[model samples]
Target: MLRYGDYTLSDDLITKITAVARHDDLVPSFVICQLCHETALGQHPNSISAREDNNWSGMTWGYDDLDPKTRKSGVQVTPGRKRPAVEGGYYIHYATVEDFLKDYGYLLRNGGFYKTSGAKTLWDHARGLFRLGGAQYDYAGDGSNSEKVFNSYYTSMKTIHDALNADGSLDRIDKGESSNMAGLQSLFSIARQYLNEQMYGSGHRRIVDTYNGQNPLPVGYKLKIDDDWCAAFVTAMSILSGNYALTGGECGVERFVRDVFQKKGIWLGKVRPQAGDIIIFDWDANYWADHIGYVESVSGDTVYTIEGNSGSPSAVRRQSYTWNMWQIKGYDRPKWDYASPAPLSVGGKSIDAIAQEVLTGARSYRIKKNTSSLFE
Candidate 1:
């Protein structure tokens, strides 16, 4: 199966989509999501827009009269019936895939895609599509109760967007292109460092000290050696791994889910998870989440997690569970771009980041001959 973000697409559609989007100065991830929503990534069962006419996204013909001068208005053709979401007037037909992609990009930019609300994030662009997309998107086309339509559209798009972020599919698609594997590697390394440590006993000081010393946690908060550390452990590791920007900082499971994860748009509620995601467990089967941990790996239906406060005395240990494990509440999945060039609160700029800046001429370090020190 060919994959692009959370959903698998029909034959090599991602390459063409990304190429046209990048070339046309459109957001690739949003374009991918729009395509997936419109035509199921060029493979909608009852729709032959992509297969027959090279139309990926469900771009209907603008009006009865075709204007060849308009960059977006391609040849109009009567096409097969599609799902209600995309059912509309005459569909645009293209002679080639390249023609369709290029026209799609031109249509979005030159069309009525106004009011992006800064367009900083995927959700922002999605909102722009509905709110300001009267001439093209048509979400508010019918007119009455447009706010209700927007909310419903946003909720559905959020699910698609969140899944794309969680699986590292949007890793390279996001702005600045952070490395997801680098962040995962750092978490694994940190977990390995505290694997054999004891909890709540006389020997628990080391892990506690290491966490406190290493992480620049926000003021007014610090953990005791024997305190409930499951949440602390995950947050601290996130901070230390240079993912503070993505994961944020939180000490309580419920607070983290509601405040940090959901607030930042990385919380996946009751969705199938992948490795390197944070898992919450409620042993009592209550909606209140009781414990937290990060997934170590996944094999078929089983999920392996390395957790703190798991045993009788709550020491760090690896445990395995089924995919539908009863104790699981939800997940706190980080976006694939964990080590972005954006500011990381836990630590200053990393060597890799520094090197990138220098290469791009955004930064330069010079040694002071008088003081024997350097500044960038």
Candidate 2:
């Protein structure tokens, strides 16, 4: 049993997270874990700086400083400080914990931190961020697997959570419980209890592709198409995986990449591309940007993609594509905002119906409105 002063380790953070979570009615533990993982308890100088300036991660403009507010904070790197720096190298700041929690909650809700709603429980969200989502401290280019990285972060988080939970420290300090094992179970129970009222109140189910004989979409679904297949593939995959949003409208490939930078404030181009990052292309030879694909693997200069809506039949397909063949347009980062999954509605009908509407123009089957609600 771990303890932090009068309160248990898990309890203290849980109370802190809950104070903010109430506004969104989501789990605060996940956010707390992420902050701990990202800033190392605000001990890192970069985290302190970034937090003060509303830049959760230290993403600076190259040469030119954009955003007058951030510019005033001196957010840009000092130049020639090496490509990537360690711990305090990337920091974003906020004035108060309330502000920090608000931004943190926003990131968890709409910034692409998790799959669309219900699919990822709070625990999964916390674990995922600690795993491959947050800023990478080590840049040695060691070929360690993502699973290994996840386990390492998860272990550290568990230790912190345990310390917070030992004697109900969080509850006494901030009137909330821990968000680890015991607390997670409670959250799931609460979510299930309010299933009918929540947007993604229904539980998440595994999406199956019936066209491919009910097969799960390949980890990196790919296919070859004559024209630009990048955008189509992203839209197709989102629908196939039940991650599409009809209300905010389906975020196309280019929009998706831009959103990662704009909405989430993540600096994808500077970071090393990982397995799930989206890779863009200038397929049409136009500078305006044309296509995109999810990176499946990268060996030397050759990269593979799990593309959708490409090749004959125009269905979700997988095929080998060369990295060199396409001009590099930067990486499409995943932010994993699952807390407040966007409501999908078009023409006054449910998003599922709208998905069907869009799919008619697409080569794949679209989700149907009220088709097998999962949570309830």
Candidate 3:
């Protein structure tokens, strides 16, 4: 129960905020912060439009009034000015809060503010929203102008953001609950759900492959899918499971194994693998992964995995493995919390869990030589 001004934060508001954030792939904290700025968390007298007209984001009224969805004409009077008798004014009105938030999401998404500069942080998104409204202030600037008067509006919204984060009210949105995936359940539940769907075979491959295909290819990307689509299935499952940002969209097994897994340090030798870990395999022991799947369980020296493209129909199945199993190239584990029946250790000769390896390998090279040994 967040309290600000005269407004008590409701679950309905949170749900609408979450919906907009997920739909636009933006952070919900920033969206709500912007809403706080716009409506003053129901404090600003002008924000009465939210309750009276269901207009929450300062949207303007249209020319025609025939559409029932469009409510009363919006008006925003200055502190000293009286409300005009005309049917329209500066702000927009809506029939419902849902319509208002949905339109705000559309503005953020289709208006090119989110795409061009990117909204990676709460402040970045807030600044983007401010820019959308033609505000010239810096996103990270102190809340003071030349008059030395603090901008209470901006400072107040920022405080709201800080409070939400400090109290963990923003945790749900931060953890992808806006995307319907949150908590420890999210770390594995989505993948398990896809596995239960039992999507398998080349006939059903299109379902996952087409989903993975939505990602735009980088410039000069030439490799295309033509054969076994195990990687595609894995990548698609990750996207559908709401972990696409973590698993990535690589359709090639070798690319996913080397680029996504190894590059991110999630790649590990099949030592003490756990459930929710992605198992990549090479059919020929050539160090080139040709297939991938999710680890289901581990019993003694045997490891079980749910893999797509297993049998002749390319169906998904759980395969068991013994010690030193061939085709068991390595495992790629998501850095998330899950129910691991076996205890995970960090070091020693024991098969320590291997998901948190430090980032290594040089990003660039420079030429240097010893001056003292020039004669030698």
Better of 1 and 2 by TM-score: 1
Number of the top-ranking candidate, with TM-score as the measure: 1
For each candidate, give its TM-score against the true structure. 0.47, 0.34, 0.40
Better of 1 and 3 by TM-score: 1
lDDT of 1 at 13: 48
lDDT of model 1, residue 224: 80
**Tens digit per residue, CA lDDT, model 2, 288-342:** 4555555555565566665544455443334555544646666643432231232
In model 1, which regions exceed 4 Å deviation? 1-179, 201-203, 210-219, 341-376
RMSD, every candidate, angstroms:
16.9, 16.9, 19.6
lDDT of each: 0.60, 0.40, 0.52
Judged by lDDT against the true structure, how good is candidate 2?
0.40
Collision count of model 1: 0
Give the worst 10-residue stretch by lDDT in candidate 3.
367-376
True lDDT of residue 130, candidate 1: 62
lDDT of 1 by residue, 1-376 (tens): 2364444853234545654564445666777776766666777775676667777775666666654334434523434334366565656667677677766676566343543423566666666666444334444447566567776767766777677667666645433233446767655665655564567543244344433543344343667865787886675455444455656655567787886777765665654556777898887997888789888887767889888777875677888888667888877667643344223222376544543343344543332211212233
